[model samples]
Target: MSGMSSTQPWDVQRLPRADDKVFLITGGNAGIGYFVAEQLSGTGATVVLGSRNPAKAEVAMAAIRSRVSSARVRAVRLDLADLSSLRTAVESMEVDRLDAVVHNAGVALDAPPRRETGDGHELMFGTNHLGHFALTQWLMPLLSTAPAARIVTTGSFAAKSERLDLDDLHSRQGYRPKRAYGRSKLAQMYFGLELDRRLRAVDSTVASVVVHPGGALDSLTPSRPPVHARTTGAWLRMAPAALLVHGKHAGAWPAVRAVLDPSVRGGQLWGPRIFGLRGKPCREPVWSQLTDTSVAARLWDASCDLTGVDLGTIPG
Candidate 1:
């Protein structure tokens, strides 16, 4: 249990080569996603941003370009809230194969009440978990082209609030905004870990890893609050430190490390080395002994059924 601080062991600057490599980052326009893209693209990787709003995507691309004069970056439309959007974006992208798919996009619905996506699934469940679930499955084949493809999905410290709520995953029974958000994040971790298990079973080149930002950075102060009040407050306390102590690169380090670090262990969690909720990058444990393996198995089947994506060819 490391605590948040200025000192940490691993840093992404040590990475050797990223030139010519291709990467796709969901929600790459802002927050840790933006930093992840910046770090990778600065190193010469061709980073494609997946954003819900095409216009915002362009703006994000421009911002990154301004920072990294020679950064290779592009933006494409990707709406996790709509299954159709995810399909359209993936089909339209021109990359033959991706070196990594950073599954970082997620949503939070606070206080007002439970909401539903265009596909009628619980907003949090659909956007945060199912949306990325489908995207990763669809792009799984393209990832195999790389020597060691990685899938870095974002989770949250809030996941500790509860286990998988299989009976009412959509929060239909008792819709609590915070609870729904937590459930979605928990699902992400379970799926990420399970995907790793599947990859090992099939000996696939792709590896699934999960990371959490611990908290938001102060730079995001103006933009971060509206995402979700409860979530914002839960993470805001760490923002000052996240910004002052870690900055953009530090905020994005968990996912960046999870994606590019060869030493990253499949199914292992990474986050701020200090309090884990906030600090620099390092390996951290998240799952409990009672995490419900059966739920993981069932959720995999349910995701395939929900997304109409075939997992038969992929590992278990």
Candidate 2:
């Protein structure tokens, strides 16, 4: 419920025109992130994708151009695991203002012998949480320059059930892949909320919003050739999953709405409206776990200490 006086509901196909605005999406080369970038480019905005691989980024950009005529799209080299490269990644954008940034890139390890990032931090936690934490610091100057810049963090439903064990942040003990991944995403969700609180306290023009792509499966996703293609058998095999989940294309809606929806406010959580699993995007209540100010604050401090980048100093 956006509480807007619209005869029709929000249409994923028809987004509000964001011409002249510059939007950035990390991991916009594949999966749900690709769809998010594709849909956003339709609004006539210059979409910059943050990808570690230039070749893959070019392929995704080519696919977008073929689908959407007059699409303005490009990519920058971004490797979230390496902290030292983040400043250069932000610098490569070369834009005076950033209208919005979707922190959609993440590293999810399903099974692992507990790997670590280049910085010796847990891979999932470092890339998904700390990488984004540091990236936001570098992007702050450009974000603050926009009239109403937005920081949209793409969280996960897995984050709902996890709690951070600050003592063993690197998972030196009792390391499970799923648990570690969930905690990493949980930290990201916490950061988004904490950042929103801080931004609100300062009355800054920048807004930090959080969103989750409930259950996006490739079986239900539409194809963008060369970038991705679903086989008929795979679609049939996973068709039943659609009853409870939707395609990755649909999953991009929540994050897309968070970025472009004017009615959305800072600190709000958007997700699938039906059972918080599958449906169109809607303003969902903050999960009780996510609303904990204490955890959010603690995580914020730890993130700052680890990243050596403070979000506390956003230019006025």
In candidate 2, residue 204 scores what lDDT? 90
Tens-digit lDDT track for model 2 on 1-316? 2233344578887788888999999999998899999999998899999998899999999999999998999999999999999999999899999999999999889996999998989999999999999999999999999999899999999889888897887777989999999999889999999999999888899999999999888889988899989999999999998899999999999999988888888999999988888999998999899888998988888898888888778665
Worst lDDT 10-window in candidate 1: 221-230
Task: Provide backbone clash counts, one per model.
Answer: 6, 0
User: Number of the top candidate by lDDT?
Assistant: 2
The global C-alpha lDDT for each of the candidates, from Candidate 1 onward, is 0.78, 0.91
lDDT of 2: 0.91
Q: Please estimate how well model 1 matches the true structure, expressed as its whole-model Cα lDDT.
A: 0.78
Query: Model 2, which residues run further than 4 Å from truth?
Result: 1-8
